[model samples]
Target: MKNLLILSLLYITLQANAQGLNERVIKLTDQLDSIGVATFEANYSHGLRTEYIVTVSCELYDDSPAPIKYQDQQGNILSVTPEQDKRIRDLWRRSHESYDLIRSTSRLLAEEGTECYIWESHRNGIDSLLYSVALRDFTNQQDKTYMPDLSTNPEWSKYGGAKEGFILKANPSRFLPNNDMEAYKKNRFQPKSEISFTYRLTVEEEDEDTVYYVDYKEFAGMIDKVLQTDGVKSHPILITHDKGAKVEDFKSEIISCDITHPDLDGETHGTVYEIETAELANTLRRLLSAEIGNYVDRHRNLNYLYRPLQDYSGDMRGMFSSNNWVIRTEFHTKHWYTFDKNLSCRVLLHHVGSKAYVLVLESVNDFWLPKDWHKLKSWKNGVKEYLYLQL
Candidate 1:
């Protein structure tokens, strides 16, 4: 009777845990939907205009310590590192600044131009826009900005993996009209948006964050400071979290998931399923493997960056493949996946298990293959069949 009762209890507990995880999965999905995504096109709202406009928001604080030094130095002032100077200036703007600033230097941009939006830090986790200015040439005497007015896809329209690109200074892209070539050639620039920004940011003085209201001159300075400083800028003002997603649900043994694929890119977004149980984590890995195996079969065009991902230089997809193992939060191994052996666009399943975090990096087309290769063939020789999804 005791054993039977214990077994019954275990069954009931497992059922309840599953029910909770399902709820958490739903909440994660809701959070993604609520936080939303930002997308913009040249024809979209306020992307371009004939008028010169500038907007600013600076709130005066009634409480907190009176404004102190924007840059606090102890020993020799010259000894202060650039990073330290930035921290001091940033804190002052958040805590001390009283005035508001706004300016519109737009003149020749009426036809086509780039606009820069300035955002400033605020108190209690609040950040407000310092101002926005339009540039006629996307370049002025001091700085150069990339204009999207003439381009089909501008910075404003970027979402997901699309945001991390480079702003290359080159001749007009193929998207530009042949007639406009002469004009575009006179002043040439291109954009390469990318995934990672300067990783040099330090959060040492994060506690000093406060709100700043700005004046036109101060607003201009704020813009210049962000452009010049490496790690001074905070998160974008427009990005905000609506409600918190409960983490408890995903940590349960039920293998809750909150994953999304923007589809425009070959990557997945927001995998926040937290697993505490080792057994549960293993099960989740199997589930992920199965799902990914299915995904690869359907999406044969997928590519991996490097082949023989492990140094062994052999078939890595095999289970017993000798990839180096390291101990961390959990047992982990990374393998590269691709349609063919060519290195272009590929997905890397990093690599995770207990506290597992799966990362799907960018993919590229197999450019090395012969041009006459058939798309539907199992292999180049039409002999062996592709078994990617069967895994």
Candidate 2:
């Protein structure tokens, strides 16, 4: 009697929430008498003739989340015994298995290729009978668990990227290496073959299909305009790991590519911009001078300042080379670029193929150049080796 009353109360609660939806959807609920759960949606159209459509769904399987507990005579809560725990675990697993079986049942029905029974309903009640269930194009739709298609432009399929998902243009073209994330982080400056602007498709959720790229023309314009500067030789090529999928479940077009330079080793020569003008030389001189002056000013009072040029010691280290018109720098790395950190410069003018003076600051803890110290050591060394005028 006590157990019967408890079951009766549970039935009332289930009926209020689901109204026999579980029994209607599943044919073999006899074994699931204790813990089955279900939900449903219904539609009704009424006039002299009535029409209705009903869709039912079952809850996902879960491990036993709330096991039965008891209140002791002293009012403290107590856990179930070992035997009861075992039974609860079994019951929970059964519910989970049942839910999974129901989900796969639709796939099984498709394979069977025929309907055992077909029923339709009207406003009054289920009355009309229909035959045949059309199979969805699972290959094209990919996954139907989530909603798809919120595209504003119908012609988005012609361009690269998705047609209905999220896509953003990286202004400076930052590529995240998706093929191997670890390797990418370690050697991210690998040279890229393609020099064109890239538009990457991004996914917000797993089920979202067809990501689209807007403002493709606008972004293209930004990348090309930078090259119009005088004596601008080249721009940095980008290569990254990207998880962005394209709209080519059918056919995809490669929108961007770089023409490889046969002689250039991309790893050491990975720079974002290239300047070939005399202005490039001038700018390097001014920047170095300013930074060196700041460093000497800061550490002039230090007792053990190892002035390389003993005669030009004190606050005149940076000043000695400021008057010179020529400055030498590494051909490959002078143009190299990284995301944020400073580039390593080498003292070499052989690649420049012209009269040039190089700067190499071997060690300057006493100076404040950050990493701006060029490779040229002293002005005197410029007169000795690779000298092209000490100024």
Candidate 3:
């Protein structure tokens, strides 16, 4: 009877393992539709191997009555802006100067490390703008640096691997286009604009069991200063918890923290943490909401407008298979503009995991606004309000 009981337990364990694996596969299939399995596979094979993948999609609008133009570093017009000629010209000139500086001074640190260059220029006579260029070499094996290469590799070409390259430039623009001209005039047009480039690289490393997935999105907005005489001094973002907040309180373990451009005041900061369990996850949501609420209340004297989300069945239907969970919060206010009775701010939290892994999605909607500014005009027209009661 004891032997039979032992056999029964073994059978149950096997069945449970099989069930878990099946669930994971189904989740993967569902996520593939949203994130593209091919892209995920390429990143998994070449970049840092992450148990969880987070993809953020954002839409930016140019609401000015003028046209907006975007250009490459080489003065090539990538996007045309007819009405905003002055703004576009200023942007192009700034980009060109920075590119020229990077091309002149940038050099390879090691055979396989990274090289960076910065250029400083002035916009509108008073505002100072800085442009930066960075190139990473993934070919050197002797280097112990942690930066991952996304470019395709010549050696790995036979096995279907590739190396990636990217170039980006940023300058401050008027954050509020029309109504806040006074604030924009005072700041001298210094706000933040971030652009990033990403590609893939292939290298042959032993031990296929160890997957290397380099997350470039996390590296966005990073800024560093080199003394030239000495090595580079990077001022990355610092992550400090509220005195008693323990690692476990975060729901996931904190793996890494980086600050981009600390020299600039009031820049957005980013943190990457991993979640471990569902109970811890519930705690994480509460803590995040409290933190954001405290921040808004302290910084602004605005009343809170909360929009309770509808049932999430459609949005997060197959999250279990991908080992993913998402939480969304929207805060609204009536004071931002003359129109738009309800101006809402939203945040999305994504929790992704594998065995012994947790990834948190914070500040997903931190800097987003409506795509069509004309919508605000409609809000001023004032529509009637209706109320419904549910039994």
Candidate 1, which ten residues in sequence have the lowest lDDT sum?
Answer: 38-47
lDDT of every model, 2 decimals:
0.24, 0.27, 0.28
TM-score, per-candidate, Cα-based: 0.17, 0.18, 0.21
Q: How would the candidate models be sorted by TM-score, starting from the highest?
A: 3, 2, 1
Instruction: Give the Å shift of residue 216 in candidate 2.
Output: 58
For 293-368, candidate 3 gives per-residue lDDT tens digits of 3332232222222111111232222323332322222222322323212212223334333311112222211221
Give the winner by lDDT.
3
Q: Write the per-residue lDDT of candidate 1 for residues 1-391, one digit (tens) a residue.
A: 2333334323322433443322322332243234331111000001111111111222222223343223223423245666775565454344222121111111111112244443343433222222222322233333244334424634333211121111211121343354253443332221111111110001011222221111223322322332232222112111011123222422342121221211111211111122343443343333333333333223222221111111122222331212211100100011222122111221222213223222221112111111111111222211223222334
Best by TM-score: 3
Query: Under the 3 Å rule for N, CA and C atoms, how many clashes does model 2 have?
Result: 20
Q: Model 3 off-target regions past 4 Å? A: 1-114, 125-169, 174-183, 186-391
Where does candidate 2 stray beyond 4 Å?
1-43, 46-78, 112-147, 150-391
1-391 in candidate 2: lDDT tens per residue?
2333344324322432342232222442332333443222111111111111222222221243554445565758767788887775665565455544443443353344221112223322111222222222112233333222324322112221221111111111134343343443333232111111111111111332221211223322333343335554433222221222221311322222121222232211212233354444344333333332233223222111111111122222242333221111111112222122121221111112222233232111111111111221221201222112445
Task: Rate residue 209 of model 2 by lDDT.
Answer: 26
RMSD values, in order shown: 28.4, 30.3, 25.5
